[model samples]
Target chain A: MTVAAEALAGRSARRRVRETVVTHVCLVIGVLIFAFPIYLALIGSTHTSGTIGRGDVPLLPGPDAVANYAQAWGIGGGRFMGVPAGGMLLNSLLMASLIAVGKIAISLTSAYAIAFFRFPGRMVFFWLIFITLMLPVEVRIIPTFQVMVSLGMTNSMAGLVIPLIASATATLLFRQFFLTIPDEYVEAAKIDGAGPVRFFFDVLLPLSRTNIAALFVILFIYGWNQYLWPLLIVNDRSLETIVVGLTKMIGSGDAQNEWNVIMATAVLAMVPPVGVVLLMQRWFVRGLTETEK
Target chain B: MATLTLSGVRKSFGATAVLHGVDLAVRDGEMIVVVGASGCGKSTLLRIVAGLETATAGRVMIGDQDVTALEPADRDVAMVFQNYALYPHMSVFQNMAYGLKIRGLPKPEIIRRVDEAAALLDIGGLLDRKPRQLSGGQRQRVAMGRAIVREPKLFLFDEPLSNLDAKLRVQMRAEIRRLQKRLGVTSLFVTHDQVEAMTLGDRLVVMHAGHAAQIATPMEVWERPADTYVAGFIGSPAMNFLAATLEAGGAAARLADGLVLPFADGSRAGEAGRKLTLGIRPEHLRPQTGGLRVMVELVEPLGAESLLHGRLPDGAEMTVKLAGAVHADGVLEVMPIAEALHVFDGETGRRIEPLG
Candidate 1:
């Protein structure tokens, strides 16, 4: 081949390699930017509170990792109004699991009825439920607290979970999914002598498995991250959730915070939600993006 | 198997009337096909008999039991849907056994019945496979097996083979007919395709505008349609209609172009100048030495026979099915066999039978 043509080809190949190198460098920087804070938290959890208060961020692990975790799990973090991380984690787990299951159950039934059955004021009822989508817990906190107070459910586990269970997002999601189910399935089930209840359990419920699994991940995270509602309703230390209890570990401006125990609590709190997402990663991705309908 | 009867079944959704008052009797072990165009309420009528739909006005009886008020479950009828409607989660065996399980049948009995049905449909090996894992025809057989295992009093089929390819549809059609006949189940099959209606049904109910235009055996409906609508709907390439008037004391009809054609039977009662519609199937028209002349427009060959589409001398278009292949470019003389000619009153569209 000609020398000029060979030179041009060589230059283009060099340019392409340079472009690839630049792209990888940029992606590495992006990853570090996101991962740096979590790294700092992990390093902080392994240090003594004194090391954190020295006003320089600890870049490496310290020697107190085992002690900090043990204290966080066994004893309360702060001296006054403190709750153990272990009990609080259990409370959080129960509340989150209950909220997830409750939301899926209610949303599935309500969505099925709205999608399949003909009733008086069906659109009106659907709109009423859908309107709840516009109002999150922050907006209805005062009135909901008042109702919970009157029902005498405050300071109880039921107060922590039940009031947070009616979810319009999950309902709308399931309704969209249920709409994709063909009418022929219902008709075939009816002819096969399945009553409405039997059809719901046998055909409809089984068809909704992937959707349920997908929604569970979102609901679990949502339930785990809840702080304001639980703080308002449950002041009892025994009923404190991990998220709320984590905040209670910080002292006022003058007093030094138990940075090591608090960071350990944060790590522990990350475990369940992260584990759930990882465990159901396949279905979560599928449910969120690929609807068979 | 049981005899089925629908007396004056009527339905309406709000102000839109879907099914007018209708009456039909389905004999024991008979398969009656309800055929019509979309929106003709054929599916609605089948749903009513299946108890999936409630008729606004009528009594439905399966054998001696009045099933108008019963739920589909209590009505003891099984249906095969157009989409097959196999449960997405269950294996074929589980799907077939579910109804029996619901009825609290013994486990062994359920197994035996499901196995029997699977063997009958040639789907025994597919019993453990989910519905989505099977092909369309396999899913259809599974659906049929599910229905067959129920041993219900009546069977309802709502265009079940419509989803398959043409060849598969033809094969499944014959299979379904053979199975239904072997089982001797009273069945009502609904479809919009006239070929399916003709080949599958012992009797055909041709629906038109929410009304039963004709109810008769396939040959009877083809040979002597009760009205112009039925005549036009039941035949492929459709029946040719031409405007004419009764003359010669109803013994003959005078065409719009001033040609006269005799009716098969010696006719008697119509007024001489009454406007009439003459119906002739495509296969009944023949080339004659002296007949109505037509200007040929297009020809469609179907291997064994060729259809010559042309305009009659009166300017009305018609199609003639000629035996073997025939090429026509300009004009041809074609005449309808007198015995195959149909006459209807132009105003009411009702058949005008000869006074025998």
Candidate 2:
């Protein structure tokens, strides 16, 4: 009986190892499939425009990598789009930061009020805000653009950021988190002589650090990847975000396209969002899964 | 330390009234425990004192001032919650010092008070650690430490030790009692555990259905419970109640099975033939010959002593506690000590005292 049991265990152990090997092989294949396009873009950016223009997809780097990146950084790629990639990157950074910060600040307070206070029409107001989730930027773009134009915010950073700041998704997430906080903490704070404002800044804000970090990463990427809103609202070259500017760098005619410089600009555009995710990865996972409270 | 008073304190949520009317005056430095079963309005009374819940129509006076209309922070009260409610992000020192900081105390004073509280609670080594890192007992100490540093007019503890394990609960209970006495802070503690209430409170207010049924010392409440509810609630294995009727000119009670046990204390005021309830503590029932017979069905050995659960001949369930182990499968004759008998009016459930 003991020998038979040992033989069964040995077979199961071999099966487990085989299953693990198969799973890892599948995972590596999946990673390569997803990363291949980005890897190709990286290789394409290093080559000269003439080499890419001849339609030879080089898997290796070329010597003109420095010249291509410098051109993209200083003068941009397409002739019609005169704004430098450097200026556009700065514009994108400002817009994304403003949107992320503004959304978090507004959502935190609004969610706090909704969760903690007993005001009339509170749920009504929450539902009103929630209803807007169904009407995304694309659904109400024309009216939003008209409002921006009437407010004289067109062709400015405000137009690019302010319209996207009121995020219902973030407010809902924060409200759910705030509701999970035990009423004992609120009572304890009150007994400790902390008023509503003091409690918000001292207790509520510190406890929400992880949630804020998680939301900031997601919202920053949301703001950074905005293509349509910035394209329509900002006509000035100075306010052109890199996402919209990158598309403009690729001209209509095949010969007119500066493929190498455009690829370099695309790579530059990916840096901030990727860096944000990497920096905030720990807090992001923790916030979504567990609450410090 | 200050006196706490509640006059005609009533609370209602919409149509459901939780506390009909509760009046309690706690002396300075007195630890009064309000204890009852769940939903008995003991917690509601504590919250009213803390200003966490507004009394429907009453006045709450802390020391010389009426604080009924004031917010919880302005009430000069500190509460230790059941879950401890320690700020998870803050270290132990910060949690203890938070109230003082909010009150705008000078930095040095705040540090001194927190350090003093930390030492008193024996948590000096854990001041730098966050609440999550501490064990159940340490967290309990931190919660008490937070309450101590405030030096508030009143301390409100809302079932603070219910979250600990059994052995730790007993240890913390003793520590809390010692600390409260040393600090001499007027406190109102609420709990459902009878043992906790008995050991901790200088005076216990036994609440039943939103009413303070009896208010007295633990021994007084034990020996002379004001009503059947208090009599049954304060004792473990509960005081076994037997239906009886006043007889022999209110000097004795006749059980349903025709056993007439004469009162050794004194004669009651009730007229003859009046329905009455006779309460006998489990330990007070002695096994003897020529006594009330009980059929022993289950025996629970509790180490030094054992509890015998059986039924009387009249079909009323009774429990008897006897010293040492007794293996009895048949009927056991147990007699109630005449001096330990408690008589209550059957209809009203109120104790019937002897006539003067």
Candidate 3:
């Protein structure tokens, strides 16, 4: 019996080892597949444009790294796109920060009202807001642009962000979260002499910390990656976002594209969003999975 | 401390009435427990008193001030919720001091009050810990501490001990009672547990179907239940009710199987042949010769005593509590104590008191 049990355990252990090996192999392959393009962009940013123009994309870093990046940061696409990469980065950063903060503020308050209060037409208002989820930005872009034009909000940072701030998804998530909070807390707060405003600032806001962190990371990335809306609304070169400016920097026909500078700009544009996700990764995961309440 | 009075308090949610005019006058520094089964509107009564739910037509007076229209905060009442409802992010000190801070108390006074409450609850060591870090019993202490620090006119507890484990619940129930008495705050505690109601309350308000069935001291309520409902609801291994008719000139009740049981007390004021219900507690049945024969079906030994579940000859179920172990093959004869009998009117289910 002992011999048989040991043999069975050995076979099981071998199977476990094989499973681990297979899982790691699959994960490494997945990581490479996603990271290869960014690796190529990093490498391409190090070499001269003439080297890339000659169709000799190098696998290793070249000697022209500092010069290429400095030129990209100071001059940016040289004639194809005149706004400096530094200024464009700042614009993208400001727009993304505002959009993330604005979306969270509006969603938290709206969700709080809909979840906690009993007023006339409450469900009707909630459904109206929920129904907007079916309408994506692409679908409402034209009408929204017209509204922005009427308001004379075009070519401004507010114009880029204001239209994108009303987030149905965030509001829905927050409303679901708010509903899960036990009614006992509200009763306790009421008995504790906390009015609606005090409860919101003290209890609700503190309880929503992880959720806010999670939403900030998501909304920041969403704002940073915006292309079609910013491309259409902002005509001024100074207000160009990095994501839109990168594409415009590539010359279409019969012109030598500054491939190296564009690659450097692409690498720079990816930095802020990546940094935010890394910084908030712990809270982001906890927000989705755990409830402190 | 203050007296709480709820006069003609009624509540309805869009035509469905939850509380139907519950009138109660609680004395100062007394803990009154409202006990009932679920859906009996006991929680609604507590909420009404706490100003969480507005009574449809009533006036709530705390001491001399009418607080029916006042907000919960303005009424100077603090509540301990079933879930404890401690602010999760705040430390124990912050949780206790939140109300004091909201009232704009001086910082040093807030600290002193929080410290005093923490010491009282024996949670002084856990002052800086958040609620999530505490055990269930510790969290319960923090919740009570939060209420104690407020020094409100009234303390409202909404089944606060129901969330704890059985052992923890018993321990916390005693702690809450001790604390309430020590603070000398007028309190209204609501619980569905009869044991909790019996042990913790100075007086119990037994609720039934949106009405206060009986309000009396725990012993008084047990010794003389107002109705058949209160008799059955307030006792463990509930009192067994037998269908009978009044006879012997309202001095005795005749069972369905022709067994006559005389009332040991004075005769009731009901006519002969009037339908009546006789309530006898399980513990009152004693073995006797030539008594009502019960066909023994189940015996549940409870260490010191045994509970025998059987049926009378009329097929009516009866439970008997007897001291020590008893081995009955098929039949066991038992007679109920006459003085321990409770008589109720068959139609309205109200108690029929004996005449002078």
Candidate 4:
């Protein structure tokens, strides 16, 4: 009976091992499928432009990583319109950071007012702000550009940042989060001798830290990937964002493109947002799961 | 510590009136508990005292100041909420110190008061820990500590002990009473628990619907409830109410089952044949050889005491608390001790007092 039991145990263990092997094989295939394009981009960024132009998709990285990245960073690829990738990178950073901070600030205050206060037209005003979520920047680009020009903000960082910041996704997220904050906190703060403004800074802001961090990651990525707005507003090459600059590098069809440098710039463009996500990953996970009551 | 006075305090949300003219006068250094069922505006009344809500038309005076129109910050009051709204991000020390800090108290003063309050609450060692890290009782203590450090003119407690478990609630109730007395801070506590109200407050306000049904000492409210509502709400197992009519010029009330209960203090002011309600607490009923006949439906043994739930001849349900155990069949005879009987006008539910 003991031998029979051992044989039964051995058969079940083998079945379990086989199941584990199949699960691991599927996960590996899934990872490779998602990672293939990024892997190809990495290899292409290291090869010379002439080598990539000859239509050979190199499986392994060549030795031109240093030259390609340096050229993309200092001297961009276009002949007359060779906007330095360094300047474009700085512009992207400024726009992205400004938009992220600006949206969070506006959204926090608007969400606070909407969620905590009661006044006339509160819901109507909330609906007004919420309706903007459906009409993205692409749908209202012309009207927004006209308004920006009227405000003397065109071709400036304000135009690039402010128009995109008007979207209500962040505000809705913050309002949903703020609504979950117990009414007791507000009442407690009031009895603690905190006025509205003081309560905002002391209680509301501190309690919103995790949500703010999670939102910063999302907004930063959204701002960094802005293409249409920057391309439309920024007339000067120096003000070009890295995303728009990458498209400009191809130089209007059939102008022998520097694919290696563009690929290196793409890799560089991804670093800041990826770093932000990694840095805020702990807070992001907690913010998504935990609720303050 | 200061006196709190609310005169004709009324609150309305659109057309729905939540508090319909609540008037209370709490003496200096006194703890007054406002007790009621849910939606009875007890919390609303406390919030009005805390300046969290504006009364529709009334005046609130703390000490000598009329603070009806003042903001909560300017009212110089502190409140502890039911959930113990300790800031999740702030440590025990900082949570206690936040109000003083906001008022621009000097750093050393804030630290000293926070330390003092924390020490008083016996949470001195937990000063560095956040609220979420503490146990429920600890968090409740921190909330109390936060209120104590402020030294505000009035302390408003909105069911501060309701969230705790049974054993912890009893412990905290004693602590809160001791602390309030020791500090001598004028306080208004609101709760739906009669036992809490009885134990914690010097005077209890029993509210029903939107009105202050009765406000008196716990013993007075329990023994001489102002109305049938207060009579029913103030005791465990609740005061038993039976439909009856005045007889012999209010000297006696005759139940529908033909059993007549006489008043201890002679005749009352009610008219003859006037409809009335006879209120008798469960514990006031005693077994007698010849008394009202009842059919026992259920028996609950509570070790030292037992509760007998039964139906009278007229089908009115009554519960009697008996000492020790009694071997009995399904039927028994019981009587209401005459002095313990409470009579109310049936139409208005108002208590009918004996004549002077």
- For each prediction, how big is the interface RMSD? 1.6, 0.7, 0.8, 1.4
Off by over 4 Å in 3: A78-81
lDDT of 4 by residue, B1-356 (tens): 79999999999999999999989999999999999999999998988888888999999999999999999989889899999999998888889998899899999999989988988899999999999899999999999999999998999898999899999999999999999999999999999999999999899999888899999999999998999999988999888889988896778988887888889977887667899989989899899967778799888888998888888878888888889986656788989999999988899988888888
Sorted on DockQ, best first, the list reads 2, 3, 4, 1
Model 1, global lDDT: 0.91
By DockQ, the best candidate is 2
Candidates' lDDT values, in order?
0.91, 0.93, 0.93, 0.89
Worst 10 residues of 1 chain A by lDDT: A75-84
Task: Give the alpha carbon lDDT tens digit for every residue of B98-197 in model 3.
Answer: 9999999999999999999988889999999999899999999999999999999999999998889999998888888898988999999999999999
In model 4, pairs of residues that clash are none
Q: Counting only residues 3 or more apart in sequence or on different chains, how many pairs clash (N, Cα, C under 3 Å) in candidate 2?
A: 0
Residue pairs of candidate 3 with colliding backbone atoms = none
Residues A219-241 of candidate 1: C-alpha lDDT, one tens digit per residue: 99999999999999998889889
Report RMSD (Å) for each prediction in the order shown: 2.9, 1.3, 1.3, 2.4
Candidates in order, TM-scores: namely 0.93, 0.98, 0.98, 0.94
> Model 3, A1-293: lDDT tens per residue?
69999999999999999999999999999999999999999999999999999987799998888988898889888455568899999999999999999999999999999999999999998999999999999999999999999999999999999999999999999999999988888888888889999999999999999999999999999999999999999989999999989999987767888889989999999999999999999999999899778
Candidate 3, position A223, lDDT:
95
For all the predictions, what are the DockQ values? 0.66, 0.89, 0.86, 0.71
Judge candidate 2 at residue B270 and give its lDDT: 68
In model 1, pairs of residues that clash are none
